[model samples]
Target chain A: MDLPRLEAILSRYEGESWDLIPVLQDIQDAYSYLPKDELQVVSERLNVPMTQIYSVATFFKMFSLLPKGKHQIKVCLGTTCHLRGGGRVVESLSHRLGVEVGYTTKDMQFSLETVGCLGSCAQAPVMMVDDKYFGRSTVDKVPKILKLYK
Target chain B: MVWKISDETAYDTLGEEVHLTINGVTIRAPQDQSLLVTARQNGFEIPTLCYHRDLPSEGHCRLCVVEIGEHPRTQIVNSCTYPTQAGLVVQTHSETVLQARRMVLELLLARTPKAKLIQEMAAAHGVYESRFKTDDPEELCILCGLCVRTCREVVGVSAISMKGRTPDKQVATPFMEKSSACIGCGSCAFVCPNNVIPYTEKEGIRTIWGRDFELQPCNVCGNYIAPKYQLEHWAKITGDPVENFFVCKDCR
Candidate 1:
């Protein structure tokens, strides 16, 4: 991340701390994760502390302070979803992925996470593979879904 | 045809423009238009909540996040507030964006278990359960701000504004009391996507020009289970008016 670009982005959100979220979001959008060097630059340029930056980065579920795999798998665990077997889907993914939630596979092929809900409960037990929605998922479908991703 | 022009001078003022690409589709828009609006206008579908055209964009719902460009990489940007800029690229359906949107929907579903839209959207997203604690508390308002925005912007009555902050924010009349400014037009209820408002009426009472009847709860369950009109409406829609189906809370 360029220091000048970071400063220019930060300049647009002068005097507003809440803008920090969006700014960080923009940074993450550019890098896939908040690069440590950029975080330092943002800390110095925005007059925000590095620890504060890290805290804010980790505070929201959206921000990723570390590198991620090429593919990100998000399983929906909303209530109607949960009742409809969202948990089983996540468990199956976790077992198959062999990495706990928030961790990338050693091969860097995938990262798994459980998400709140996607507001499509009628299609409960949903998992998002890359950009597509795989609804009404069952534990049995995990292998097929993972195979498609690979 | 002699049409007298008004004395007011009309001049076109062009503001700064930004260019961005969504899912490989190039677009140009005024810098102020939210990415969501721009994308939708250009035929890119991005799902959103707490985002009604009538309401001020309150990015609390976090459902419209999208991935943008290749640089200081942030995977998800709230499309509702993100400004487009020259040379910027956006992916409305990126892997990251889809995941984030699903997570947001899941969280909302955990809080509002009975909202039909939430259910439908969750189902569409393939959510079956909230991994978090299930607060299956029955609620209708997904807190999308459409009602509040419609009341203020369309109705010209700022009777209700979102109260509180994240994790506790909600649309409510001031102090959570009956609003004096509320014309009782039921626009809030009418426009609400979640159907969270509970309309109270006594037997033989009339409300908003419609006949009112006591909504009976299930005799066994005691859930304010059935609205009389809802039952009648369902019967009309389904053409099955079996009175026995209208069980009380206890029977249900």
Candidate 2:
């Protein structure tokens, strides 16, 4: 949001167009989400088009356009996890939080989402609340997990 | 135009050929030709779905994979993008190659069982049924990305894109909203392998991917001209007036 800070981020990339993805990742990391104005600045600095940058940003699941909440919730719906009641975990979290996947709560307390896999198939039906992994998660455990984050 | 053959040796040096074997048959082809092209030229019929001679190969379909060598072990690679080199031993229809191709076709069939192209390919490969469940019966777009590549590389306008991670990946606009950048060129529809992208023209109205454009009618006859957005795109690029394109090509 600040011009000086934006300029500092832009200067980190040495005007190399191939560094566009990493530049976007760094910008998202600094601001928690990609801002439109910063993306415009990136387009101009890298001599790339806005549509091209937007394509890459929207293509990857890692990037987010909207400001994320303080705590992130990722439910694994992988083949193993889904067969082990991972869908129920997502539905339970959605019902508890009153916000669907990819949306943050109105109070900015939590953001709910789903991922392909976390590579922890041993811990089937896993849900990650921020950095902590909740293995063998259930609908009854949703409230307890939220309480720990808050 | 008639003055040619100045030197026979000069002509021979200008054009060099690469020799390769496909399915135990020897063939001579021009240097740098893709394996698919060389195979096709020599009468070896390899099934392919996502490859087009005009566009760059993305190799997403994995149907044109062929066994590359016999030393140590053979490796399967997409023949559409693989270049031809001298003395390369390639088998277009080995048992391992057939098994891999059948598996790819089965996966494609599971995703888009209703697609006639997929059904035909599946039947040809003897993959009569898919072990995987079909998420959507009417689903199309095998995620081959031919349409996306043609739009970006040929049309030069990336109105649509492929998004999300694997197993949940889909081709759509950013956020799946109507893209303001789409010019309704129908190049995506033209290049689609399974006719996935919905396109229809009725009563001088054209709709593609849920965006409607009023078709420009020819001034000479009643037949419809190109979509207004397509002509507008051409006008914007060439600095021509929209009125100039009202006349149909037949009249022009």
Candidate 3:
């Protein structure tokens, strides 16, 4: 978030096009979303176009431009999950958080999103809070999951 | 290097040519060109939706798939982006090819059921309709990325780009805000196969992506012509005075 901290991240890499993704990843690690001003600095320093950077950033699901909450909650909406009541899971999460997918709660505690697939079809109706995966999730279990997170 | 004696006329060009077979018919094709273009030129009737000769290939549609090489080693690839090489054997209408093409068409039909082009293609492939349920029945854009490629590669402007991922992906301006970078060329609309992009010109103003730009009136014919930014872009590119383009192309 600070200029000196951002510069320290920038100092580790040689200014090159190949370093763009890693640099952006580090920036996201330091600050939850990619900053416009820092992206411009990467563009100037790495001799890449800002548009190209923005294109790469938006193309991948791993990157986010908007600020994120402290805890990231991802609900799977793949074919397997969807057929197994994934939509209900999303509805439950939305009702609990008072925020839709791709939105962070007012308290900045949780950000919710839906992913196409989690490569874990065996665990249908799955949701991930931070790094832990919870399978066969139901509306009744939403409050208990948040309790453990807070 | 050996060619059929009867079809020597096909390889009359001076450049080094590669001999390849499509649908059991041997043909001479120039190296490094896309297989889809060369195959179509050779009368193979390969179908494509996202491919425009002027734009770079993104191969998002998966409609132009063709089987390459002899079985048990054949591979299916999107012919629009696949490069032609010497001694390459391709089958445009093999069973595997048809099945792959049919699946692509059916999936596309599921995404945009009302698209007339997709419907016709489905009928041609004997796919009446998709078995899968569509998330959006009115969806027209198949996310082939032709408009995005044309805007960035040909127009030299990154005003629009693809956002999100499959099934939920869409073409949008940066931040979904009014773009400061768009030149209002309408090339994106021109290249879109489905005509999904809603761009219109009326009353000396061009409307694209929910934004309007003033169109310059021709000095001689009094017709509202190109967008102001387009003329300025041309001037910047060719080092010509902006005044030189005051008259429209037809008037000049």
Candidate 4:
């Protein structure tokens, strides 16, 4: 949404070919998502290809094409989490959020994603909102956690 | 190089020649030339999908594998990227080579079950139906990446890319939407072996990547010249005036 901010971010990078990832990260940090227009400008400014930019943007799990929510909710679907009913937690979250796993809410409150592992197997069926983890999370406990984020 | 100039060969200009055998036929060729080109020059038919003479070789298709070395120590290598070495023994049609090619074809057949090129190739190899699973029966892209390579290496732009990973992977523009970066040269369409890239020319306008690019017409005969967008890009690249591209071959 802020076009001038993109120039500032672009100016920060050394314009080296390898700086593409960091440049994208900084842009995503400034804007909630990688705006298509900004990405096109980045391609032109850096003299890279849209195909390459898009490839990098989509390849990484951190980048989102659409505007991500203020809070990112990552549900762990690792083996331990799955056995402990990670699927049910995902279903509950999806039902509560009214959006699919890889989408943002209409209100831009939260965007949901399922990660393979969060490295907190001891806290199985874990869901993380930004950096805060909710361990041993159940369907009933999901609404309370959602309320805390809201 | 160019070995023959006028009436004689230039030995001094030639690279070092290396001796190799293909199916027991001894042959001498320039060292480090791709084994695929060397084999083809010696009249061997090695089936490949991703090789283009003008484009850089990237052995993406894995369809050109040939068995190297003798029995008990044989190895399969993609002949397109495999350079010719001295004393190198290659089997372009050994039973192992056929089996490797057959497996490659079978996997390609399963991936793009509807691609006619793969269908014909499969039939030639006596593979009627794939034993593997066909996730999308209508899928035609075998991910050979010829179009992707041609666009970057030749056209000199990334208007499209091989996006995603595995079954979800595809060649697409940014965000899979109409890209403004595309010059509509149709180079991607031209290089696509599967011929699945949909584009059409009507009147004098060329439509590709969901955008219309105006084609310049020659002044003399009124035939369609290259796309004005493409000509501009080429003008910038080659440093010739944009007007120079307006002249058709016949007029030139």
Per-prediction TM-score: 0.47, 0.79, 0.81, 0.83
Question: What are the candidates' interface root-mean-square deviations?
Answer: 13.8, 2.8, 2.3, 1.1
Ranking by DockQ: 4, 3, 2, 1
- Model 4, B16-49: lDDT tens digits are 8999999999999887778888898889989989
TM-score of the A chain in model 2: 0.93
lDDT (tens digit, per residue) of candidate 2 on B40-110: 87889999988876667778889999999885688999998888889899999999999999999999999
Which is the winner by DockQ between candidate 3 and candidate 4? Answer: 4
B62-93 per-residue lDDT for model 3 (tens digits): 88899999989999998988888988999998
Worst 10 residues of 2 chain B by lDDT: B1-10
Overall local distance difference test of candidate 2: 0.83
DockQ comparisons of all candidates to the true complex: 0.01, 0.35, 0.37, 0.65
Weakest ten-residue segment in model 4 chain A by summed lDDT: A40-49
Local accuracy by lDDT, each model: 0.71, 0.83, 0.85, 0.87
Candidate 1, A1-150: lDDT as tens digits: 577777776777873555677889888766667887787667666655443455566557778867778888999988888898998888888999899988999998998888998878889988897788999899998999999978
Residues A26-102, model 3: lDDT tens digits: 99888988987888788789976566677778878778898899999999999999999899999999998999899
Please report the candidate that would top DockQ against the real structure.
4
Q: Please, what's the RMSD in Å of model 2?
A: 6.2
The true-versus-predicted C-alpha distance at residue B161 of model 4, in Å, is: 2.1
Q: What total of clashing residue pairs does each candidate reach?
A: 63, 0, 0, 0
Candidate 4, lDDT over the whole model: 0.87
Going through the candidates in order, what fraction of the true interface contacts does each contain? 0.00, 0.38, 0.33, 0.88
Candidate RMSDs in Å, in order, are: 21.6, 6.2, 6.0, 4.6
